[model samples]
Target: MTRTVSDVIAALDAAYPRELAEPWDAVGLVCGDPAEPVERVLVCVDPVTATVDEAVETGAGLIVAHHPLLLRGVHGVGTDTTKGSLVHRMIRSGIALFCAHTNADSADPGVSDALASALGLKVLAPLAPHQVGGTTGIGRIGELAAAEPFGDFVRRVAAALPSTVPGVYGAGDPHRPIRTVAVSGGSGDSYLDAACAAGVDAYVTADLRHHPAGEQLEAGGPALVGVTHWASEWPWCGQAAEVVRAAGNVEVHVSTRCTDPWSLRA
Candidate 1:
C-alpha cells in the first residue's frame, strides 16, 4: 500500500510533538512535499553527506533524521555552504527530509531510553526528566541488573555502539562498581553537571571534548563513556523506524552507512 509524506509526518508529529521542541529548535518536515507518495523511508542519526547518499542508493522517498538539517537560519541556498548543498541535493533528488531533534530526545520512548535498552540497562528514572506541560524532562538514569566494574561497563558500551575505535572516558576509579548509570545520547556535556547532581556512578554519551572530560574528571564526576556521535545515537534511528513502521507498514530502512564526519586514528 502507498503512503503519503503527510502520513509519515502525522505519525512522527503525533509521536514527537513539534510543539515540544525548544523555542530556538527546529523540528518536523524540512524538505519534500507532504503530498508526495512515500514508498520507502530511510532513518539515520544525522542527515549528512554519506547518509544522504545512502538514502539515495536505497531509493528512499523520505529521510527521517534525529538532527535538524537547518537548525539555524541560512542566508542563501547556494551549494557553496554545507546546509545549502544538502538542501540542494535533497531537492534535486526529490527526497524529503524530516528532523526530530530535541523533541525526539524529550519524547517518552526517546533517545536516552532507546540507548539505555541497547546497553541492557534498566531505567530507574530520567537523568533530566522530560517536562510535558509541567510534567518533567526526558534524559534517563538507570542501572544494570548486576553491578559491573567501570572497565567492564565500558566494554559493554563499546560493543553496543558502532565505531572504529570507541574511546572510554573513565572518570571515577576503574575498579568502581557502576550500578546506577546515567545516559544522554548526543553531545551531553551539559548533563555532566546533572549526572553529578543525581550522583550516578557513571554517565555514557558521545562527542566528549578533551577539556570538558578533563574538567569533569578533576571535579570527580560520573565515569564517562565517550563514543562517536553517530554510534551513540544510531540506535535511535531503529527506534524511530519502529515507531513509523508500527503506524503502518511503510518500507523503512535504517541507513547502514557511517555518518560520523570523522576518521579516528589509533
Candidate 2:
C-alpha cells in the first residue's frame, strides 16, 4: 500500500481541518505534487533550515510543521531569500512541506491540549471557546487535580517540556497556590483576557510581552509561567506523528533538532 502526499495531507486536514485555521494563516501543502508517493514523514515545530536538513538526511518525503515557513505574502521565492532557499532545498530533495498552525491550536487534541496533558491537567474546556463549533478553539483551561505552589508548578512545567537555553520563568509570588490553570502554546499573551476570564490560578504560555504581562499581573490576573516558544509547542510533534502513522504505513520521524531562534541567553 503506497501513500501519496495527498493521502497524508487528507489525514492531516482531518486531524486539523483547514477551515479551523486563522483567516490570515497559510495552512495546507506548501509545495509538492499530490501524486508524489510518500514513504516517510518528518514532524517539527519549525520548518527552518536545520529541520529541512534533518528531513533530507532522514529521507522523509513529507515535512509536517506546526508553523508555516512563509506566512505573509511574498513577491518571489528566489534562492536569495531565506525562505526561498528552504523552498528550493525541499523541492530539490523531493520533500513536501505542510503547516498546521492555528488549525492545530483550534483542534480538540491540539497543541494546547497536548501541553495541558503533559502537565497532568484535567481539561475543562477551551480558554477562548469558539462560538461556532463550541467544541474546538484556541488554548485550554483545566485543573491541576491538587493545588500546588506557584514555584512547584513552574518546576513541573520545565520538567514536562523540552529543555531549552532560557528554560522556564515565572511571575507572581512563588508561594501562591495554583489549582485551576490555563495554557496556550506558542505566543499567547493575546489570550491573557481569556485566561483571566476563566479565573485560572495560573497561565502557562510562551512569548509573554513585558507591558502586557506586567499590566495583567498588576490587575491581579492569573500568575504567568513563561516558556520558550519551541518548548511550549514541541509536544505536538509526537501527537501529529501518531496521527500520520495511524493514517498510513509511512515512516514518521519527529525532528530532535532545537530550531528555536534563541540559541543563547546570558
Model 1 lDDT vs. the true structure?
A: 0.84
The TM-score between candidate 2 and the true structure equals 0.97
Regions of candidate 1 where Cα sits further than 4 Å from its true position: 131-138, 209-212
Q: Model 2: per-residue lDDT, tens digit, 43-118?
A: 9999999999999999999999999999999999999999999999999999999999999999988999999999
lDDT tens per residue, model 1, 59-156: 99899999998888777878998888998899899899999998888777788888999999987777776553432255688889999899888889
TM-scores for candidates 1 onward, in order: 0.92, 0.97
Q: Which candidate is the best by TM-score?
A: 2
Q: Give Cα distance to truth, residue 121, candidate 2, Å.
A: 1.0
